[model samples]
Target: MTNEIYMTSKAWPFDQARAILRRLDIEKKRGIDRGDKPVVFETGYGPSGLPHIGTFGEVVRTTMVRNAFIALTEGKIATRLICVSDDMDGMRKVPGTVPNPDELEAYMQKPLTDVPDPFGTHDSFGNHMNARLRAFLDSFGFDYEFMSATELYRSGAYDEYLLRALNKFDDIMKVMLPTLGAERQATYSPFLPISPSTGRVLYVPMKAVNPEDGTITFDDEDGTEVTMSVTGGNVKFQWKPDFGMRWAALGVDFEMFGKDHQDNAPLYSRICKILGGNPPVQFVYELFLDEKGEKISKTKGNGISVEDWLKYAPPESLSLFNFAKPRAAKKLYFDVIPKTVDEYYQHLDGWSRQDEKQRANNPVWHIHNGTPPDENPPLTFALLLNLVSAANASDTETLWGFIKKYAPDATPENSPGLDRLTHYAVAYYEDFVKPNKAYRDPTDQERAALEDLVKRFRNVSAAESNDGEALQTMIFSVGKDHEFENLRDWFKAIYEVCLGQSQGPRFGSFVAIYGPEETADLIETSLAGNLS
Candidate 1:
């Protein structure tokens, strides 16, 4: 690997915001050179309920660009991944509707803003949601500063910024109201108002004070009652400027947000300038749609959650989808994921085989069919899945040794590597590919092809040929109707013959890479229903 990646490609097709960040980095560094760290970027998220794969996508892309920035400036400048959970934003309703809403009934009728933490120990409902997201980030190996809105408010980090925005409330409001709808502006009790006729600003007054019955007032016009029994305490400013005040106090350099928060960015920018903070970095990613093409949101309850997808799929499979495109509107379903995941990784593998110079510029965006011939073994997850459903190879050491012989580049590190492999294998064996559950069962056509292919494969020796390409081509020859309509049809056919199912793996190449006898044995056991 070289320190410099030649631009074999101009830029990654999926990331325009990254290109913007790179340009901004040059400007940021001019400031950093004079002895300022210039915290380069920050992104905001809401912890109202269960986090989704889309959430992971936002953070992962942020982290990758941060890594690029750190690389670009040679470590002179610093960037941080600040996961700001808008816990202080009023909680509208319990997201999932727990069976025991009564159990949480005590928390109702309070400012729908601050409900009790579902996990019971956290100070508020927002904290509970933030904790869930934090757990997922930790599981994904992201390094970030996890901050809760409630903590920042209680700690008074936003005190100075808040006071400044409050003082300039009228000026900031002039810039804010035109952005809200007329009807919204009319009843905009909690929002900053703008003149409908002139779009001139009218600021909402805000302060940090609690009323007699435990209600908290923003500016003395109207106050929200604090649910003291459910949550231990309550303290907040009006939501609009609170975010702007936050951007300044946190030194957030860059943050990517979903489109739902598009209106808030301008307001936050105004508040950032008012509070004397740098305008935080901002990128607006699109939404994740449900199988039916509806946007996934707390109100819709329509999308598959991150936890749900993780149940029967590989982490990288999820990564593949998120990384494959720029954040744009796309349809997703829990079903038929393996077909997509296999194709994606194969495409990645092809990219790895591309000419080195081309591979350097955009390492992650290479097309699979063009990947350079590198020693990088397939992800342990793909290999293990093939083994689980192809043959009865249970010994991790044996598998590792085989991997060393074939692709000496493969590393057997920690449980994550193992877990990743186990997950993919589960998806393959189950033949179903949703977040919650997936099970594999070979079709009649697949079984017939596998039985024939296995008989042909037995005639060859384990060490005779190791080239994956030649092996794949040879297997394709055995099926008279070998012309595949797409990658899915080909993969399904391979799995069928090898494991007595329509799809299992690339048999010829898998056997060559994994070895002949082991490959045969795996297929026999999986087909016999002994391995899954």
Candidate 2:
């Protein structure tokens, strides 16, 4: 932490963005005063399974910090954002998310880069995963340079670092042993040698290390001593030292990982310092869980895939999901889609209304990489969903009619953004909302109140009706008149009994988008116990 972080009294955006910038500024200044080392930001990817939302979240969140750093630095400093893939890691087990689990059993404990691609597309399983990870990040237009651990180690990119670790094996063991069980502590080795016998990397205990000759002599499973040079692709590291070694070797300035790694990240920081290297500034975000708070993972295959989310909502909502207070674990489920979409619009709404200083605090500003997109599609996803139900719209043109009615400035030529959102809204409604929609029998009090509202709507022509805000006010007035004190229950009844959910968008905007006449028809249909 630096004093630049606490200078929010000066009206800077006081959040993760500012803190990231402040930390980078402190590091950059110290580095410059010393020798002007390049500031490097890194996010690691585990290519053990197919990429998911959590995979996207880390890079996206890091990019947010990178963007914030660049904004505060005004492009003054050189920065490198690196995405490293641990493809060299062994395929310990076949991930449930992947195809043909049984086939991978033969390759268990072999380096991932050597395991055959079950999909038969890429040369190896690790290569397939690496390609998929790249495609995933590229889909979101993430600005990052990709590095392969397989290439790095096999080609001697990490040879110098590998030798350093070999020479300091005892020191690495000192840093790593306390956390291990007594059995593990007795056998722990900082380096795993590629076994000459089984032709797979072995975690067997080292009998001796020749730093002078760059060879590690380790005992095989049969207690046969085998000596292999640490150079070439013969050696890779266990994770704790691997992390520290990479940071020291690559000059990583900052990085972030999950809270589950909370205990482990610091151990790497310590090992890095022991290796005569400074640790990267670290941030630990909470882990991702399903809607039920169950842990999300590749083996479980329990959480939403990146494809399903982008199919249902705009990609910007994903950014908004990442931009929230990262320390808090959020539910990354389909249920969160509507709220995130609406919140993105809310930030856009604030950006238009707030002055330049305050707009910097807006999440959309950071999400868009400091240039907020033009305020278009001025409707929320929840409201659009309600409109889909209100008009019973099956396609875009019908929805466009309502959009054009609400915003006369919208035209087919200019409203491509709205067109895309309309398509997403219709698909989301049909897939997630419509099938679950059931007609709830209206209560007697509710029936009478809705009956009165219908009568009022019957008298008011579509052209002469009050706008969304007025229509919203009048509906709430019916609830208040009937003494339904809980506005939440009132809205729940309106949405569930009418729209077939416990909630929808703001009623005023929903009514405005669907028009008062259509809303009346919807109310009348629900009141009459018809879900047509």
Candidate 3:
């Protein structure tokens, strides 16, 4: 029930937070003075394309761990989350999802911060995407400081680290060269100098390195040899070197990345140490897959974005999706929305009944940073979607008409959460469920059972019809009397005949909410082969 119990929680966030504490202990034992500086948490972003769902996931997951660390320390330790955008990285290729692909082709190999903004919004493509990233994170009310790699490099923030990297260039190369193929290793250099001739980031090998002068010499695009300072934005490290340099320069205490970076993690840590700074505690989460089980890519735009998820579901549901089984690859698509929405509310509904230890492990507690909302929806999302299908509702008002009748006390004003769900249900039903509906004629046995149910409904009293449990009992008896082998098949028949779906909400509750007489009429319509 206390913070002490939560500190020992088996939740993944707490596990990661504990790793940070262990790292701090090790550092203190080594006589490393961290002083009163806060433990820094960093999440990186590549601003070559629009921010995607994967970007959102990293921030959300990191925030969860940060909150866990705060709870474990009981506010004794200060913390900061830095969201740094790698805008200075070269535009290797034009993203398929962005506008004006042809225009971007001219800017290939240029730093993303130097490319023109295709949307005509910000000064550069990188700035536009950075703005979008900040806006997206701001909408979630995340507490973070946004840093641009270009700004950091140009403003002398990275000068010291850049010069240190120059001094240890050969050692850094020794860490990286083994990872590259023969052809790549032949041309590889830790530093990528920005060419003065073409203003492009050249991938050419360094001709000479002067640690004293803190500069590098490389040939320009026109085959003219040039020497430039590695400091003050004149040069940027290749990605692997940049990753470790960022940890050292920023004094990052904790950070997380995708599984794709797992193999390179050791190299990063080594480079960080080589640059005279300790590597941060790192957490490697699994990558997200698209609907087809292909890895999601920012350039290819193969997966959904945060805005896409928000269109059919609330933000809390998306947060729940990001929170669940983070180390396992999840299929991010529209089909998962309804299930995640229901699961989010299910967790919320159970949060109050859970003990402190149980609550600490609940996803909603982490989603809300331990202060989850007290609101509970009257119906599950699955039930609402089923209601939409049965009622053929196209709008929120129509859905609410039946909802108000079922629960007289609930209104759009008092049940804001439920009201929002109604809107999402209607939208999701219209976009996904309706077009794919397949209504089939019942078999002879199913028809007989349906007729028997309609006959029983005719004799039902108003009080029994209003009570979901009572109606459920009656429905169960009908299924048993009709010799249905599996009760699930009987429910399936009801869903297919009346709702035009293979699965749906509880039939008894549907009957109670929609009225017994109305359900009987629906079955009769289905029997007449007209419901679909």
Candidate 4:
């Protein structure tokens, strides 16, 4: 209810915010004067390829924590989310998913910002991907300041940090060398100088490090000796070193990354402290998996995109997916869409009924920044999909016709949320549910139960037919009377014969919405093999 109460909330975002507050308290006690600075939450992006769902998840989750922190502080401390794109990093390999892959091969070792744009739209490959990243985040209306690694380096924004890194080169090397293979250890350096002649990032071992002059001497690809300043875009830190350098340079207060970065987290923190800066609070979440349970990869493009999710469901559904179980790995696929959509509405419907403490733990509060919209769709997504299958509805108008008949008071104007769901339902049913629907003839006992159900429906009064709970009880009684070994088998038979699918919504709810006599007619048709 109150900000003070919410400060002790058990919600994951609130928990993360509390960790940050504790970190600040510790720093203040240590005479670090961090109270005046706005807490900075950073999410890194490598602009070598198009942004993926992982990128969206990180930014959104960080935003949730940032909002929670603001609420906990009650506007006393400011917060900022900086989305930094590492466009200056070298492109190791061309992504297979992008257009014109062959054209990008020549620029393999060059910084992504310097490589040619395969799409032919932006000045360079990294610029094209970064624009897409910005557009993606902007579409969600996220509050973040975009920073380019190329711009930050070239404009001397990282000059001070680069000089610091130069001075701590040996210390940084001590932290990195053990993790590398024998051959990689021989060539690895904290600084990767951009070659003047070839304009490529060289991964050569430093011949000499001159901390006093803030420069490094290394052999070029041609075996020619060269010297370059670490500052002013002359050099960029390798990814591992860059992670800590960014924390030190920006004074990042919080960051959340996937579990893939868990092993190197200590390295990042060590390097941050080595460079005379405190490491930020870290939140490590499990990685998202594709439908086949493989880790989702931007380069491989094995998982659904944000646009793909929005195509079948609303943005709120996607947010709910990200909000739930950040610490557990989840299968991000099309099959999970309808379930997530229904879950989102379920949360929305229950938000008003929840007590203050319960509301604090609810995902919808974090999803909508503690102000969830008042939307209570009367039907679940599963029900809508079944309605589409049974009525063979191809458009929202057709689906809305049934919705109006089922709930006389509900209209497209009064129930805009349901109206939107109808559109998504039609598209989802057509794309996913329709093509896969399978109809099976009922067994002898199942046919007898169906015939008995038809008879019972004909005898039901019109008023009773509209009562979903009453109808559900009647269906359960029918299943019991038929002596079906498992009630699930009876429901499965109904789904296969009547709905032409292996799974369906509550049959009683379906009868109440579709009309009892109409459902009887459907059963009779299935008995006569018309549905099959």
User: Where does candidate 4 clash, by residue pair?
Assistant: none
Badly placed stretches (over 4 Å) of model 3 are: 96-101, 298-301
Error of 2 at 124 (Å): 1.8
Backbone clashes for every candidate come to 43, 0, 0, 0
lDDT per residue as tens, model 3, 1-532: 1268777788899989989988999999999998999999999998876677888899999999999999988889999999999999989988787886898898998999999998999999999999999998998999999999999999999999999988998899999988999999999998999999888998999999999998899899999999989989998988998999999999999999999999999999999999998999999988889899999876577888888889889999998998898889999889999999999999999998999989989999899999999989888888889889878999888888888778989999999999999989998899999998888999998999999999988889977977889998898898899899999999999889877889876788888878888889989998898976
* Ranking of models by TM-score: 4, 3, 2, 1
Best by TM-score: 4
Q: What are the lDDT scores of the predictions, listed in order?
A: 0.56, 0.80, 0.90, 0.90
Segments in model 1 whose C-alpha atoms lie over 4 Å from true places: 1-35, 95-100, 109-119, 189-241, 263-278, 298-302, 313-317, 334-423, 431-507, 510-532
Candidate 2 structure, TM-score to reference:
0.92
Give me the runs in candidate 2 sitting further than 4 Å from their true place: 1-36, 96-103, 221-223, 461-466
Residue-wise C-alpha lDDT for candidate 2, range 129-158, written one tens digit per residue: 999999988988998999998898999988
Which 10-residue window of candidate 3 scores lowest in summed lDDT?
Answer: 1-10
Check candidate 2 and list the clashing pairs. none
Stretches off by above 4 angstroms in model 4 are 96-100
The true-versus-predicted C-alpha distance at residue 466 of model 1, in Å, is: 8.0
Q: Candidate 2 or 3, higher lDDT?
A: 3
- TM-scores for all candidates? 0.66, 0.92, 0.97, 0.97
lDDT of 4 by residue, 1-532 (tens): 2277778789999999999999988998998887468999999998876777888899999999999998888878989999999999989988887888998788988999999888899999899999999998999999999999999999998899999888888889999999999999999998999998899999899999998998899998888999889989999989998999999988999999989999999999999899888999999999999898899876577889988999999999998999999999999989999999999998888999998878888899899998999989888888888888888899888788777777889998999999999999999999998888778888999999999999999999878988889999999999999999899999999998887887777889888887788889988988898873
